[model samples]
Target: MAIGKLFIGRKVRELRLEHDATQSQFAERLGISLSYLNQIENNQRPVSAAVLLALADKYGLDIAELSTGETDRLMSALTEALGDPLFESYSPTLQELKLIAQNAPGFARALVSCHQAYRRNSEQLASLDDRLGRAAALEATPYDEVRDFFHYVDNYVQELDTTAEALALKLGLQGGDGQPILTDYLDSQFSVRVVHGPSAMNAVRRYDPAGRVLTLNPYAPAETRTFQMAVQVAQLYASEAVENIVRQAGFRSEEAGEVCRIGLHNYFAGALLMPYQGFLKTARDLRHDIELLAARFGTSLEQVCHRLSTLQRPGMKGIPIFFARIDRAGNITKRHSATKLQFARFGAACPLWNAHQAFETPGRFIRQLAETPDGARYLCLATHVSKGVGGFRTQRSSHALALGCEISYASAFVYADDLNVTDKSAFEPIGISCRICERSNCASRAVPPLRRSISVDHNVRETTPYQLS
Candidate 1:
């Protein structure tokens, strides 16, 4: 296979501006002409090997920094944003979009922001039609803002995870039992007392910061109780580190920041419960078995699935998996993707996915060999998880947890052992969302695709009511 050229134009310009060097001065250091440097900076010419070597040798810059993952994210976001009906007449080619992301990333980000503002305004205007004379402000929801933040960061916080792992090691929380070690650590370090509160409190976990008391619902399962305790410990002990990350996130609203703080605390708790290296090694040894890993780590299946999605730690990365928790109503409550598959931003997931089917056979795993509309294949697994108070006649919550990775990694998953991964006929087709999917003959399509014209013919009928053009 032929390799693509590496273009570091944006990174070069950023470095030049950071060093406060003019074009001529910087070109002299790189042993290149000013015009050639300008060409490189404008992305008209790819960065030469000599220039890359000079960048590292002269400035001690890391060559890996030249390849910014932000360009790929910007490209994907711009593609989605431009898919709106407003840009139907001006569709840009993928190569053209790549140039925009590489050479004019700032302008590309501005365009995405403008598109988001337009969407918010359009939604507000639609709401205004329902309630006349009431002013509705245009704004992105806090959930969306936080989701976008994690999406751009690829859902990994290295510093916080590392700190949590170090704390785990320092507290002697190795292997056997994490709950008691965590409980003892809180008492010794912060003088905080962990106690079981009344089930009537109706809260999973509550911490009285002023009173130095940590309370948990007595009805929660043992795994849930321990996880909640870890969350509280993260909030109390890792506040400084979590606050620093939140401050640097540059969220547009305070609500977004607050939501991110809670998210980071949850992240720290997961890391504390399952330290990175040990968890990765065990996951690989067990062939990424959720049940065995949960049993070994003394965590829940949901916790194991969620932790697998966050194993994107640079040099020590694990399998790239997408994890989602969907309610019985088909709403995706929690989602993160380390793979190419992204969940829909708004509304429910595609009805075609096995995650919906998992709810039908509660507590049983559903394995699927699936392919997306984009032709990417995956080995998916989903199971329903339920939690409630430990008594009869109490409200219970049930949600389905879905975990999957690319079909190329199927051999590493024990669930794929019974399926034939090489057979093209075995893979079931799925889509990210109904609005964007191009599949025309779908029997379950609820609405016409946004980018395709539909034809309704009275003379003939098929699986679908309309044919897409």
Candidate 2:
């Protein structure tokens, strides 16, 4: 792949501020004129080779850190946000969006956040029951805040992941695997007791911090038990790392902090179960077969799918996959994308998506060739996953998981082997949501596009009754 030019304007500005240098002073130090330095700082021009050498020589900066990973993601998201009809009058050009993303990233982020708050408020107003109940809390809830935190960070927590990987290696002392290994680690390392009994009812797992005892539900699956144990182990063993990350997150409320703390622990547990390097090697070897990966790593199918999405370790990233889990009501409970295909922030996904069909054929994998309205093609794979404790009276959780990479990387996925990726006719059209969709003639649009000039003709209808101007 041909790499684009480096734009480290934000990094350069940060460095300049760290040294408390004016633009002129910084430019002089970098052997550049003030105007040229101004252009570079504003991302009007890419950092020149001379400037790069000057930075390396004078400041000992890492040139690799100049990549526009976060800026590109922000530009993409900001572009999508501007596409909403609410900004139609103020629709900026592509160049303007890039400048906003590179030069004033904080402002760009604020705009995106404001747009999210607007959409959330709009959605709430559309539902009377919810509006009546949640009208007081118009701002984002704790869960939404945490989800965005994960989304903007690319869903990878480096400090905790490395800590968990080290813990995994340390736990492999006795050479055993799965829950037995985790239980043994807890018992030997912390003088903790892992117990399963009929008394540890309803809840899947419970930990008594003061007593240093972990209780697992006897009825839960072995994988579930193992995962819970790993989570508890993470809470106990990786407390320092988790606390450091939580403090850095700086959530608005104590509830969000608590939620993030738990989430970090879960992330740690997942990383421990499937250490980075070993899991990546096996994933490439098996072509990312979720079932086989689950069995090999002693995890559930859902865990493997979720873990695949978090393989965003810099310099050793797995395939750029987008993962989402949706309920029967089409509510996306969990979502993260390493690819360009971002999900809708407030509503259900497009009806044409293959993930929705997974519920119809449980236990079967559904492979799809889908083209979004923006012309991006994806080789998507979806499957239904259900978990229960075993009794008819017991509760069971069921959701469909969708995982995929871009069509260009489909060769890395085993599920895409039989897919007709190149056949334009084989690809179904999808959109982020109908409200912002540019496709007016879509057969499955649930509602009309917001603020669009539409004429509904009772006598004639073409796919949809409301025709877009």
Model 1, residue 296: C-alpha shift (Å): 0.8
The TM-scores, one per candidate, come to: 0.70, 0.71
Q: How many clashing residue pairs are found in candidate 1?
A: 0
Model 1 scores a C-alpha lDDT of: 0.83
List lDDT for all candidates, in order. Answer: 0.83, 0.83
* Candidate 1 pairs with clashing backbones: none
lDDT of 2 at 349: 84
On the 0 to 100 scale, the lDDT of residue 344 in model 1 is: 62
Kindly report which residue stretches of model 2 are placed more than 4 angstroms away from their true locations once superposed.
1-139, 173-176
